[model samples]
Target: MPFTFEPLPIAVAALTFLLAGFVKGVIGLGLPTVAMGLLGAVMEPAQAASLLIVPSLVTNVWQLATGPRFGVLARRLWLMMVGVVVGTLAGTGFMQGGHAEQAATALGVALVAYAVLGLTAIRFAVPPRAEWWLGPVIGVVTGLVTAATGVFVIPAVPYLGALGLTKDELIQALGLSFTVSTVALAAALAGGGTFEAGTAGASALALAPALIGMTMGGWVRGRVSEQMFRRCFFLGLLALGAHLASRTLI
Candidate 1:
């Protein structure tokens, strides 16, 4: 309710955005993963998701608009988009009920499972059996996490990567995924009582950091080695998930 752009909050916002963007830039994903927890400490979970949405959109748009694989990304486009839209809506709707800590605990657990899967090289697929249904399942998980903790980029990335898609397809899939998620979140907020004008404005303010982070991340993308960055990213996820889970039990 208060509008005091105090120096600390501002700085924190900028750092969070910058760090998130950097992660995305280097690995082609994980901005939300990097920033969600930090943002949660300073702002409500819903507000944090709203704030990052614009910046995330901008970053993805840039990739889709200027990258070299738009045409390739066009094929199979509808399916992935639809999935993200559904999942994001489901996730956000769950958050509307105000389950911050529980969501965090659940998300941390899921991330730990996913990370372990990633490490163990487990193979899960949408099943020749109606991937359409599978899409929303991913969407709901992502959307809930996005609403709860501001990090919905996890499952989508690994799923896409596993398909052995090219770089363009990967980027484009993420772009579409975020787009659908963003729209769904807005609609969900409108339906719920949490959609406030001031909070939206604050979210907009936070977008700057996200954009800046993406910009910096883009530059870093070329320079950073993927193998190293990924190793670090997974390790970071493990650490963060462990911390989150520990907090829940303690």
Candidate 2:
């Protein structure tokens, strides 16, 4: 492992994943989003994304398996997952191939859009009749974005929410979708040659603090007012996104 960094950056990475995992433990999502946005400051988007794969994949798998309706949701969402794979592979190297600045700008834009949607709390519905077609479309778009920015919750999360699943089921469904996205992104990164042994080791080491944070967050979830927390979260994301966008565009 020849990667070099001062102790400050290492501390930042630890704190970033800890915080990111805590957020996920509380809200059931946002681990990759938080990690990517914060880590982007100290590393390339591709490298940041590489560091995210292990923690996100392991946590989401746990989320997916803990649910009661795995078979049903798996059957329902397989089409969308396939689309995700296709989109990710098709868009390989878009972010890693000398497009770092554009990728950062795009990452900032993603964070901004997601924050605005969260703050507004707008909701949409998808008729049962439309899921067959719409789901895959959303998955493809999500996968393309994941390929670029390492965030996959955009259209996919909203669409899953619209499916009218119970709370537990929705969380599990998200886990399923995100697991697919993580694996696809790994394949894409590997294909691009950015997912090397040292990078893989870095991602593996991040899992510990992430798990610790998730544990702490699970304890806090029962005590905290999630609404207030979410408001603050989105506001912070808005500011972070704006900072990234401004810093890059300036």
- Identify the leading candidate in terms of lDDT: 2
Residue-level lDDT tens digits of model 1 in 51-135: 5666666676666675666666555546666665666566555654666778777767766776676565565554445555655
Which residue pairs in model 2 clash with each other? none
**Least accurate stretch of 10 residues (summed lDDT) in model 2?**
1-10
lDDT per model, in order? 0.63, 0.80
Q: Would you give me the overall lDDT of model 2?
A: 0.80
TM-score of each: 0.78, 0.85
Model 2 vs. true fold: TM: 0.85
TM-score of 1: 0.78
Instruction: Kindly list the per-residue Cα lDDT of model 2 for residues 200-230, writing each as its tens digit.
Output: 8888888998988877766665465656655
